[model samples]
Target: MANDKNNGQDNLRNAKASASNMYEEGKAGASKMYEEGKASASNMYDEGKDRVNQVYEQGKEKAEEIYKQTKEKASEIYEESMKKVSEAQENLKEYSDELVKTVKEKPLTSLLIAGGIGFIISALLKK
Candidate 1:
């Protein structure tokens, strides 16, 4: 009976030791998995940030290109408008010169035409 009790005590002690070892191994494995998961999450976050930054840079560059294009187009339009205005001014000056020359060359005919136009305008105003 004494030997049987000693055997039972030894078995119990061995079982307890085995259970403790299994618990320690499980804890170590869980800690390792947690660390790996944290590292993976950090890597994913960094990659996401890098992608966002790259997209932001591309957008900024595109906006700058658009702005430059718009500025060039506006400049071209302004130049075209100025050129048209200058042409119109030149045309007006030429017309004025022609009229002055005609008036000087044919003063009597111009006076007769002006008088006829005045008579027509006064008649319309009366109606």
Candidate 2:
């Protein structure tokens, strides 16, 4: 009977020790998982932030490039318009000079033509 009691006590002590070891191992594993999850979350956040920054930089560069191209095209158009205006002014001057020379050479003919044009304009105005 004494041996049996001692053996039973030893079995109970072994079971208790096994339960304690299992509990400790479970706690340690849970702690390790929590730390690993936190590290993974932090790494993901950093990667996302870096990706956003890279996209922003690329967008900014594209916008600047477009702006420069637009500015250059506008400058070229302005120059072309100025050249056309200068050419028109020169043509107008030449036409005026030619008309003046014709008037000086034939004053009576010019006067008659001018009188006819004035009559036509006045007639249109009355209508």
> All models: lDDT?
0.99, 1.00
Predict model 2's lDDT versus the native. Answer: 1.00
What's the count of clashing pairs in each model shown? Answer: 0, 0
Q: What is the lDDT of residue 123 in candidate 2?
A: 100
- Name model 2 segments beyond 4 Å from true: 1-26
Question: Model 1 lDDT vs. the true structure?
Answer: 0.99
Best by TM-score: 1
lDDT of each residue in 78-118, candidate 2, tens digit only: 99999999999999999999999999999999999999999
Q: In candidate 2, residue 24 scores what lDDT? A: 100
Worst 10 residues of 2 by lDDT: 10-19
Tell me each candidate's RMSD, in Å, in order. Answer: 3.2, 3.1
Regions more than 4 Å wrong, model 1: 100-127
